[model samples]
Target: MMVPDRVEIDAAGDAVLAADQAAALLGVALPAFLADLRAGVVFSIVERGEGADAGTLRLTLRRRGTERRLVVDAATGRVIAAEGG
Candidate 1:
């Protein structure tokens, strides 16, 4: 099993690289993602468990009272899983 590279988190607890990739995947700009983070949106980078998503960066985004989780490949920045809104 190959380990993914460590993702750096900013002081605001936002995973910088994962957020950038997620914003691009969502067709949004980096600024928009930052703005959302500033506006009390919840963002977190978690570790995926077993199966195909194992060892990936699981980015959970919660904004406007809606919650969504995006499973991203830390190495490739590919969105492997997206759930909720």
Candidate 2:
């Protein structure tokens, strides 16, 4: 007897948001961010929450000397919280 060559794992239906998409929801100028990034004056970080904060994405963008942070729901792509944006 031979086991199946492959097995499929099932995950509950959920909507996952991409980092770029999450950033777009903040209504910031992407072009400027790109420019600053190229000039090494801007940086970004994307993090996913766990446990009680599961299914959430935390995005932080820094440009010049300012920082913007946002918490988005992974399943619905909604901005849960925003600071300094």
Candidate 3:
């Protein structure tokens, strides 16, 4: 029951894209995306708010050593995006 027991991996919204689509949106290799996912550097979250007032989580990845940079929002634990260099 770690990932909502299957439900956790599901997205309730319509705008949400599938894994392949997400990778295309991010313009990254599939292996790289998987790496980010395994590193807990990829995620999504919806903030409680009206319309357009909700804050979004953004992840900026950078190559430091054996891992990447996972930038996230302070309020929500969602990752917006990631990069590898």
Candidate 4:
């Protein structure tokens, strides 16, 4: 298994955080999420918001048979909601 140091995403404008920044921010905010990643038991899915969800990001990490989802504020780098992990 291979893990990336940073996941860079090119999003138009400055309202959203880059992919790598979001991943790092989430790692710091959720210890268990990071642990799953370190253990190579997680797969990450990143989504950029549109319409009313603009300026936000949805980060999903799947571990084992469970899935953890989080909605993050792109500008502030704060997690708006976290489900599961």
Candidate 4, residues 1-85, lDDT tens digits: the string is: 1122323334542234343443444444356656666888767777879999998777676656766566767666566776663
lDDT of 3 by residue, 1-85 (tens): 0111011122433123345544544556668877887887776543333345354333333221332333333344444444443
lDDT tens digits by residue: candidate 2, 1-85? 1111121212542333333443353444667656655788766676778999997777676666677676767666566777774
Which segments of candidate 1 are over 4 A away from where they belong?
A: 1-36, 48-53
| lDDT assessment of candidate 3 | 0.40
Q: Output the worst ten-in-a-row residue range by lDDT, candidate 2.
A: 1-10
Model 4: worst 10 consecutive residues (lDDT sum): 1-10
Residue 54, candidate 3: C-alpha displacement in angstroms: 12
TM-score of each model, in listed order:
0.46, 0.59, 0.38, 0.53
Question: Which stretches in model 4 have alpha-carbon errors above 4 Å?
Answer: 1-40
**1 or 4, greater by lDDT:** 4
- TM-score of decoy 2: 0.59
lDDT by residue (1-85, candidate 1, tens digit) is: 1112344545544345556655654445779877987887645546544686565667665555555566656565555667764
Q: Per model, how many backbone clashes are there?
A: 0, 0, 0, 0
Clashing residue pairs in candidate 3, if any? Answer: none
Q: Could you tell me the lDDT of residue 23 within candidate 1?
A: 60
